[model samples]
Target: MTFFLQNFFNGIMLGGLYALIAVGYSMVYGILRLINFAHGDVMMMGVYFAYYSAVVFSLNPILSFTVAVLGAAALGFLIDRVAYKPLRKAPRISALITAIGVSFFLENLAVVIFGAIPKSFLDVFKDKSILEKTITVADARIPLLTFLVIIVTFAMFSVLFFVVYKTKIGMAMRAIAADIPTTSLMGVNVDNVIGFTFALGSALAAAGGIMWAMRFPNVHPYMGFVPGLKAFIAAVFGGIGSISGAVLGGILLGMIEIFLAAYFPSVMGYRDAFAFIILITVLLVKPSGLLGKKAIEKV
Candidate 1:
């Protein structure tokens, strides 16, 4: 029972992180129907931003995170204006290819700039001792960082829910998602809303990336690739366009991955393949996903 509880807690922590990144994928897909393959690279850039902010600029944690999030948000906005906006009227295939190009561009740019080596994230903190603290609950040792990650994830999601459901800007976002042409006809600044969506999604990805580095204690140029892919799977699994669905999918995927590795140690090496298997199952069984509504195109 103690062992089970430990894994469960770990699963929750991992799930929270995945959900954070998944929300980025879901929001972008919901608004633009574009995959934004560069989303993960944006996250990688965020980690680097925080790393340099702390190590080079000598900023504290609060300032480091602020710079990283804002910088990533700006990057997302710039990507849209530069790469995607021109192809907005072009075939979606063009946009999709462009997203891939942007992803590769960011990855290689990081390699050129940050080098191909991994850095320790914890070493940048002045008081790393606080993060290393642990609490024992029913014979399970849980790190304070785990609790912090979970709490932050919940708080961030709360803010996201409020923005998406309660605010006027959110209403405009929903309107655009429902019918971009009709929303433009209604006098909404469609381009601004879309840009805002990208910024918002990228900001969330940056937050997730920061928390992820904290948990894993490593920062590398390619670190975001696998997690980004997994988050995309989670978005599709839970219903790509639904925020709540992304959360659900992320948590479920995290739990499954943790439990499968825990119980079947021999299959640990093949764990990554399991995500692909799940993706295939979801597509085969329900193309609209668990919570996604079937999109009907008006001919």
Candidate 2:
């Protein structure tokens, strides 16, 4: 029971991290019907920004994290403006290929700027002593960071919920998703809404990247690759274009990952495979996703 409880908490924390990234993935897909493959790279950019701010400028973690998120949002907006805006009316394949190209460009650019060596994610928050705290549950001990991650995730999600469901901008986003041309005709600035969507998603990705770096304490040029893909899978698992589904999918994926690692130690090396397997299973069984509505086409 203790083991189960500990793993469960750990899984939830991990899921929260995935949800952060997956939300952004789903948002872009929901709004633009285009997968921003470079979304993960934006996360990587945040990690680097935070790392430099903390290590070089001697800024504390909180401020550094804030700066990182801000920088990532700007980057996302820039990417959309420069790379995607022109391709908006182009073929879907063209936009998809452009996204892939942007991903590669960011990776290589990082290599040129940061070099190939991985940087130690110096624990800037360690001195704050929050992460060092732990609580006992039966025979299990859980780190405070676990709760922190979960809390932060929900708090951010709440902000997002308010923005997505309550505001005029939220309505505009929905309208654009439904029909861009009609929304534009209705006096909504479709391009601005799309840019805001990118910024919002990129900010979430940045937060996820920072939290992930805190967990593992390392950063590299290509660090976002696998996590990005897994988060994408999580988005798919929960039903793409669905805000709630992304969260649900992320938590479920995180739990499954932890359980597999806990119970099947021998298969631990292939732990990453679990997400892909789930993706395939979800695709075969219900491509519309858990909370996703089935699309009905008028022929």
Candidate 3:
């Protein structure tokens, strides 16, 4: 029972992290109907930003994290303005290709700037207590970082839900998602809203990336690639455009991965493949996803 509880807790922690990144994917897709392949790279950049802030400038961990989130948000906004904005009027295929290009660009840029080596995230941070400490419960020892990650994830999601449902900008976002032309005719600044969407999504991705680095204790140029892809799968699994769905999908995926690896140690190496299998199952069983509504396009 203790072992089961431990795995369950770990699953939740992992799920929350994935949900954080998945929300970014879902948000961008919900608003623009475009899959931002560069979203994960934006997360990688955030980790580097935090890394440099702490190592080079010698800033405290909290300040470094703040800088990371803000820097990634700014990067997201810039990507939209520079790469995606111009393609807004073009076909979606164009934007999709550009997203891929942007992703590659960011990855290579990191390689050029931060080098190809992996850095230890905890070793550089001045404060390691958050991650180094553990709490005992019913014979199960859990990292304090796991609790922190879960709490922060929930808090962030609360703020996100509030911003999306209770605020004016959120209403604008919803309007834009429904019909860009109609929203523009409604006198809303569609471009600003779209840019804000990108910024918001990137911020969440950065937060996820920070937690992810802490949990894994490594930061590399390519670190975000697989997690980013899995988060996209989670987004699609739960219903790509639904915020709640993203959260649900991430949690489920995380749990499945953890449990599968725990029970079938031999298959640990193939754990990553499980995500693709789940993705295929979801697509075949329900193309619209578990929480997604089917769209009825008019001719």
Strongest candidate by lDDT = 3
- Position 94, candidate 3: lDDT: 100
lDDT per residue (tens digit) for residues 120-146 in model 2: 775566474565678998978888778
What ranking of all candidate models by lDDT puts the best one first?
3, 1, 2
User: What does candidate 3's lDDT look like per residue over 75-194, in tens digits?
Assistant: 999999999999888999999999999999999999999999999898656667767788888987888887787787778878888998999999999999888999999999998999
Candidate 3 segments exceeding 4 Å error: none
lDDT of 1 by residue, 1-299 (tens): 99899999888888888888898889889878899889889999999999999999999988999999999999999999999999878999999999999999999999999999888998669999977788999998888878787777778778888998999989999998888889999999988889999999899999999988988878888888998999999999999988888888999999999899898999989988998899999999987778888878789
Candidate 1: count of backbone clashes, pairs at least 3 residues apart or interchain: 0
Cand. 2 TM to true fold: 0.95
Candidate models: Cα lDDT each:
0.89, 0.88, 0.90
Clashing pairs counted in every model: 0, 0, 0
Report residue 49 deviation for candidate 3 (angstroms): 0.7
**Candidate 1 at 47: error in angstroms?**
0.8
Clashing residue pairs for model 2: none
lDDT of 1 at 288: 72
